[model samples]
Target: MKIVKEALAGTLESSDLMVRVAPSPEGALDVVINSEVMRQFGAQIEKVVRETLERLSVTEGLIVIEDKGALDCAIRARVQTAILRAVENPVLEWSALS
Candidate 1:
């Protein structure tokens, strides 16, 4: 799915993460992550983001994540939510993505 516009999901609260996705005309996946645990779990976080995008069949977009110690599942959910919101479709069955 292609991102049509900028969209955001999640919050800044503890144990949560905020994800922002936007369309990229360059046709490249660009991800930027900010987290305190970058020294240890950064690669894992990036991996999850990339995998989620691939699962959604998204090839070009700018994904920005502000992580507040969120778990892997939470990151996936937030990214998915952002992608859905960016697409602006109303009939998508979100549970089916799992």
Candidate 2:
């Protein structure tokens, strides 16, 4: 899924995470994450984000995640929502997402 425009999901509230996705002309996946538990769970969070992107077939974009102690499932949901919003297309392959 190509990010055609900027999109955001989630909030800054506790136990939630905010994700921002945007298009990138550079043809690379650029991810920036800010989390309170970066020291211990940063790598794991990055891995989750990468895997989510791969699952959605998102190869090139800029992703910024602001985590407020969110679990892995929440992070994945927010990322998926943000990507869907970024694409702005109603005809999504829902089966592929499963």
Candidate 3:
């Protein structure tokens, strides 16, 4: 339930989000979010990303996303990016784009 280095480095607004990418027993991801977006968006962010992940066929691990005002699209992108980045790759050498 920790994001580690998943976000765009400094782009992470708050530490409210927690993303986990463990291997799924169903050979797919299981995404779950502790969302409070309803107060902000008048809707639940979980259904948003859950549907998106299912539509995108992201079936792997129990992704527990803690939300704090991140939009649906942003949530999806961040989660997907985190998962992809978690996969095989060399050490990502990044510099400030600011």
Candidate 4:
């Protein structure tokens, strides 16, 4: 997805990471993160993801992210991208991709 690529190249700061956002037809968003970076900014990542979701207003689905060493900016951007991608296209799987 363009958003994810942009996030990785433009926003992801610490290291390479994988991000996914799956939205249910109901418009609910579920977010998940796992990685070394998470050990540091787990809570912040969740907040950013949730906030992004709230902004997107997706009703339902799972948003999963596999962060290697991405910074908060990276996570935020990726989450935004993933959410958009998920909403636009339904082919992507919303799971922790490593």
Q: How many clashes show up per model?
A: 0, 0, 4, 8
What are the Cα lDDT values of the candidates?
A: 0.89, 0.92, 0.52, 0.57
Query: Per-residue error at 7 for model 3, in Å?
Result: 9.9
TM-score of 2: 0.92
How would the candidate models be sorted by TM-score, starting from the highest? 2, 1, 4, 3
lDDT of 3 at 81: 58
Per-residue alpha-carbon lDDT of candidate 1 for residues 4-94, written as tens digits (9 for 90 to 100)? 9999999999888999999999988899999878889999999998998887888999999999889999999999999989985734655
TM-score of each: 0.91, 0.92, 0.54, 0.61
Reference-based TM-score, model 3? 0.54
Candidate achieving the largest lDDT: 2
Over 1-98, each residue of candidate 4 has an lDDT whose tens digit, in order, gives 21222122123345756775543455445566777756678887778667655655544676677777766666666665555554435344344221
Q: Write the per-residue lDDT of candidate 2 for residues 15-69, one digit (tens) a residue.
A: 9999999999899999999999999999999999999999898999999999999
Mind giving the per-residue lDDT tens digits that candidate 3 earns over 54-78? 5444555656666666765666666
* Ranking 3 against 4 by lDDT, winner: 4
Looking at model 1, how many pairs of residues clash?
0
Model 2 clashing-pair count: 0
